[model samples]
Target: MPDSNTKDQIIKSMLNTAFYKSAGETSLANIAEGVNIKKASIYNHFNSREHLIEETCRSCKEYIEQISFIPSDIDSVSKKYPAETVLKGIVDRYFKMHEKQPLIQIYTFIQSQKYFTPEVMDIIQAQKTALISQTEKVLLSLIQNEKINLDSNDVHSTAMWFCSAINDMLSNYLLERKKDMLPFPEKNADKMANAKSDDAAIEKINAYIEKFAELLK
Candidate 1:
C-alpha cells in the first residue's frame, strides 16, 4: 500500500485528470495510469469505481467552492435591476460555474441523479440544497423590496423556472461541449472550437443569463 502522502498525491493526480479530461474520457483505469499506479493500488484507497469517481468529484466540488463566482448581494441586485433581472443574475452565476468546471460535472448529476452512487448522490444533493437556499434568499429579498409581489404565484413560478432553466440550459451546453457541437452557435462557436480557456465558458454563460433574464418578462 502507498503511504499517506503518496495516496494524497494519487488522489490529486486523479482529480486533475478528471478536471482536464472530457467527462466521457474519465475512468478509473485512466486515473490509475495517470498516477503511474496499478488498479489494485487505486482500490487500496477507494472501495469501487463509483467511489473513486465520487472522490474525484469531491475534489472538484472543493475546487469549485474555492474558485467559483459568488452572486452579488440581493440588495445590490434589487437596487440596480428589477426582480426578474436579479433572479436571472443569480441563476446565471450558477450556470457560469457549471460551464467553467465541466470536469466537476456535479450539477448534471444533481439534475439527473443517474451515473452516481448513492453516497455521491448525497454530496451533490447537499450542494444543490445550498444553491436553492441561496436562490430562495435572493427571491425573499426581492419580495421584501417590493420588486416582486410576495403572494403572487407568478413570482413563485418565476423563481422556480429560473433555477430549472439555468440548469437545463447549462447541462445541455456541457453535453454539447463534450460532443464538440455548436449548441450555442453564433455566441459559443469560437469558444467550442478553442476549448482551452476557462473564460469561454464564463463569457457564454453570462451572455446566456442576460438573454434569459430578458425573456423572464
Candidate 2:
C-alpha cells in the first residue's frame, strides 16, 4: 500500500495535470515531471493514468462537497427569502465555486474535449447529474410552496431550465470570458457586488430575472 505521503503527492500531481493537460493527452511521463518523480515511481502509488485521474476527480468532488455549496434547507429557504433572492443565490454559488477552484474550470474545459477518457467522462457525468438532481429537488420545493410559479405541467423540465441557465452562463463565462456575456448580478449578491458598475451585464441579468419573473405568473 502507498503511504499517505505518496498518495498526497499523486493527488497533487493529478491536480497539476488537470490544470495543464487534458486526459486524452496526459501521460505517466507528464505526471512524473510535474511531481518531480520518475515515471516508474508513479506506479508505486497508482496502477495507471486512469486510476490517478479517477482518484483526482473523486478527490475534487469530495472537496467540493465540503465547500459550503448551500446552507439553507430548500423548503425553509423558499419560505424565508424571495424566490428571486434564493434563485440568485444559487447562481451566485455556482460562480463562487468556480472562483474558489479555478482549476475546475480548466478541468471541465479539458473534460469537454473531443476525446474524453471513460474515467474522465464518468467524473463529469457524476457531478452534472448530482447537481441536476439537487436543483430539481429545490425547484420542486419552491414550486410546491408557490415561491416560483409556471404554467409548465412538467416540474422536471422547468427545474432543468433554471439549472441549465446557470450552467450555460458558467460555460460561457469560462469559454468566452466575454464581459457582456451574462448579467453582472445584483447588489444583494455580495459575491458579485462589483458588477453594479457593469451596466450591460446588469441589464442582461435583469432581463434574465424579469424573464424568470414572468414565468412565475
Name the runs in model 1 displaced over 4 angstroms.
1-27, 37-40, 47-51, 57-72, 102-116, 152-158, 181-217
User: Which numbered prediction scores highest in TM-score against the true structure?
Assistant: 2
Best by lDDT: 2
What lDDT score belongs to each candidate, Candidate 1 first?
A: 0.57, 0.60
Query: Tens digit of lDDT per residue, candidate 2, span 23-66?
Result: 55667887677677889998887887777766776666565444
TM-score of 2: 0.70
Which residue pairs in candidate 2 collide?
Answer: 184-201
RMSD of each: 6.5, 6.8
Instruction: Compute each candidate's TM-score over C-alphas.
Output: 0.61, 0.70
